[model samples]
Target: MNISTFGLGYVGGVTAACLAKGSHNVIGVDVKGEKVEMINQGKAPFYEKDLDNLISQAVEENRLKATKDVKEAVENSEISLICVGTPSNPDGSLNLDYVKKVCEDIGTALKYKNEFHVVVIRSTILPGSTENVLIPILEKASEKKSSGDFGVCVNPEFMREGQAIYDFFNPERIVIGETDKRSGDHVAQIYNDIHATVIRTDIKTAEMVKYVDNTFHAIKVTFANEIGSVCKRLGIDAHEIMNIFCMDKKLNLSPYYFKPGFAFGGSCLTKDLSALLSKAGELKLSCPLLEAIIPSNQEHIDKVVELIISQNKRRIGVFGLSFKSGTSDTRESPVILAINRLYEKGYAKLFEKGYEISVFDPNLDKSDMENLPSNIVPLLSPSLEEVVEKSEVLVIANNDKDFKRIPSLMREGQVLIDLVKVIEADEVKDGEYIGVCW
Candidate 1:
C-alpha cells in the first residue's frame, strides 16, 4: 500500500515511520522545510523513544520519503492520512485550523489526481468534526462529491506521547469511521496484517471514541491522585491499596462498575462514600473527585424524577423499592426519593384516584412489603407481567432478572423507565423504554 501523510507532526511522523516499517511506501508531507529536510535526512525532528532509528532504517530501505509539496505526495500515494494537530482553545474547545488547512490542501491535490484516494483522519476530533467541517472543506475545494470522487474516514490514533511508535505497531484496536462502506473496506485493508481488533462504525461514533478514551484516562489519573492524597494523610500506602484494588478482576479495576446505568445507592456504596468524605472534611482535605460522589448521586436521582415528571402522568408505578435487588433495605434508595417527590407534586393517591399502583419484589420478604406506604399496594406476583399490566408507566429500579423481562410484556403507549440496563431496552420497539442513565 502507498501512504501519504500530512503535517509531519507527532501523529504523522510516527505513522509514516511505522507504516514504512510495515513495508508500505510512505510519503511524509509538511509545510515546514526543516521538518521535511530532517525526515529526508533520516533524522527525527521531534524527540521520541526509538523514533530516530525507525526513521533512519525506513529511509535507508527507500520505503519512506519526505516532501513539502502536497502535489508530489498525493501523486505518489493512493491514501492520504491527515495527522495534523487539533489543539485546544483556552475555553477547552478544539482548534481545528490545522485540520481545515490540511484538508483544503488535500482536496485541491485530489482534484488533479486521477486515481481514487482515501483521506483518513488520524487526528483526535470531536463528534461531527469530520462531516461538519472536514467534508465540507474537501467538497468545496475539490468541487466534487466526497464519496463519488474519493473516500473519507476518521481513523483516530490511540498513541501515547513517548510510546507512540510502539502503540502504532501494537494497538489494542483499529477503529475505522467511514462515510461509506467502500471507504471502510479501503481503510480496513491497510491494517489487514496487524494484530489489533478492527472496529467498523459510523463516522460520529469513531470521532467520539478518541474523546471518551482520553477523558476516561484523565478521570482515572485524577481518581488515583485523590485517593492517594487521603491514603497519605492516614499513613497508608496508596500504591499498595490500588494494587490490591486492581487485583480484584471480578469487580474492582474491571468492567464491573463501568456500565452506563443508574447511580449507586446501596447500603455499602452510599454509606461508605459519605463516611469517607466526612473524614476528608474533618482533615480539611479538598478532594474534588471524592467530595463529588454524593452530589453526583443526587443529580442522578434528580434525573429520574425529571423523567417521571416529564410523562405528565400522575399515576406512576415504582418497582424495586430496595436500594438494589435481593435486598430488603430501602436506605437512601433513589426510588424511595422519587416516590416522595411524586407525593409532593400533588398526584392523587393510588386508592383515591381508583388507579392501581403495584410494587412487586420477588426477592423481598413479606414483612418488608407490609411495612411500605399504605397507598403502595404490594403485590405477591412472582412475575413482571403482573407489574407491567397494572401500571401506565413502569420504572425498573433494579436489574432483577424478572424485571428485565418486562420489555417483552410492554403494551402500546405504556412507558418503561429503566434505572438498570438489564435488557436490550434501547432496541425494544414495543413501547417507549427510557433508561435513567444510558
Candidate 2:
C-alpha cells in the first residue's frame, strides 16, 4: 500500500516510519521543509526512541519518503493518513485550523486523482467532525461523493511518546470508525500484519472512543492523586493502599462500575465517598473531583426529573424504587429521591389542576414500607399493571427484568423514559421510548 501521512510530527512521523517498516510505502507530507528534508535524509524529524532507526531502515529500503507537496503525495498514494495536531484553544476546546488546512489541501489535490483513495484521519478529533466537517470539505473541494469517488474513515492513533513504535505494533486494540463497510474493510486491511483486537464501528463511536480513553486516564490519575493526598496526611502508604485496591479485578479494576446509566446511589458508594470528602475537608485537602461526586450524582437525578417534568404528563409511573435491581433496600436509592421530587412537583399541579405519581417495585413488600420516604407512600401502586394502565408517562428507574415487558405493553400517546436502559429504543414503537443517557 502506498500511504501519504500529513504532518510529519510526533504521530505522523512515527506512523510513517512504522507503517513503512510494515512493508507499506509511506510518503510523509508536511508544510515544514525541515521535517521533509530530515525524513528524506533517512533521519527522524523528532526525538522518539527507536524512531530514527525505523525511519532510516524504511528509507534505506526505499519504502519511506517525504515531500512538501500535498498534490504529489496524494497523487502517488492509495491511502492518505491525516495525523495533524489539534492543539487547544484559549477556552480549552480543540483548535482545528491545522486539520482544516490539511483537509482543504488534500481535497484540492483529490480532485485531480482518479483512483478511489481512502482518506484516514488519524488525528484526535471530537465526534461528528469527520462526517459533519471534514467529509463536507472533501466533497465540496473534490466535487465528488464520499464512499463513491473516495472513501473516508477515522482511525485515531493511540501512541504514547517515547514508546511510539512499540505501541503501534503491539496495541491492545484497534478501532476503525467508518462511513461504509468498504471503507472500514480497507482501513482494517492496513493492520493485517499486526495481531490485535480490531473493532469496526460507526464514525461517531470511533471518534468518541479516543476522548473517552484519554478522559478516563485523566480521571484515574486525579482519583489516585486525591487519595494519595488523604493518605499522606495520615502518614499512610498510598502506593501500597492503591496496589491492594487494584488487586480486586472482579470489582475494582474491572468494568463493574463503568456502565453508562443513571447515577450511583447505594449504601456503600455515597456513604464512603461522603466520608472521604469529610476527611479531606478536615485535612485541608482540596479534592475537587472527589468533592464533586455527590453533587454530580444529584445533578444526574435532577436531569432525569427535569426530563420527566418536560413531558407534561399528568400521571407518571416509576418502575423499581430500589437502588438497583435484585434488592428491596431503598436506602439512598436515587429513584426514591427522584420519586419524592416528582411527587412534590405533581402535587403542586394538584392545586392548579390534577396530577398523580405512582410507583411499583417487585422487591417492595410490607416490611419495606418503613424504608421508603414519607412523601412516596401515597404514590406506591399495588401492582405494576395498575401503574402502567393508569399513568401517562412510565419511568424505568432500574434494570429489573420485569420492566423489559413494559415496552411491548406500551399504548399510543404514552411515553416511557428509561434510566437504566431496560428497553431498546426500537422496541416501543407503539408510543415513545427515551433512554436517560443513550
Per-residue error for 148 in candidate 2, Å, reads 1.7
Q: Point out where model 1 deviates above 4 Å.
A: 326-329, 345-357, 370-383, 425-427
Candidate 2 — worst ten consecutive residues by lDDT sum? 343-352
Please give the distance, in angstroms, between residue 312's alpha carbon in candidate 1 and its true position after superposition. Answer: 2.0
Full-model lDDT, candidate 1: 0.83
Distance from true location, Cα of 23 in model 1, Å: 2.2
Structure candidate 2, residue pairs in collision: none
Candidate 1: which pairs clash?
Answer: none
Q: What is the lDDT of residue 302 in candidate 1?
A: 76
User: In model 2, where do residues sit more than 4 Å from their true spots?
Assistant: 344-347, 350-353
Which tens-of-lDDT digit does each residue in 288-347 have in candidate 1? Answer: 987888888888777787787778664566678787787777667777777766666555
Report, for every candidate in turn, its global Cα lDDT versus the true structure.
0.83, 0.90
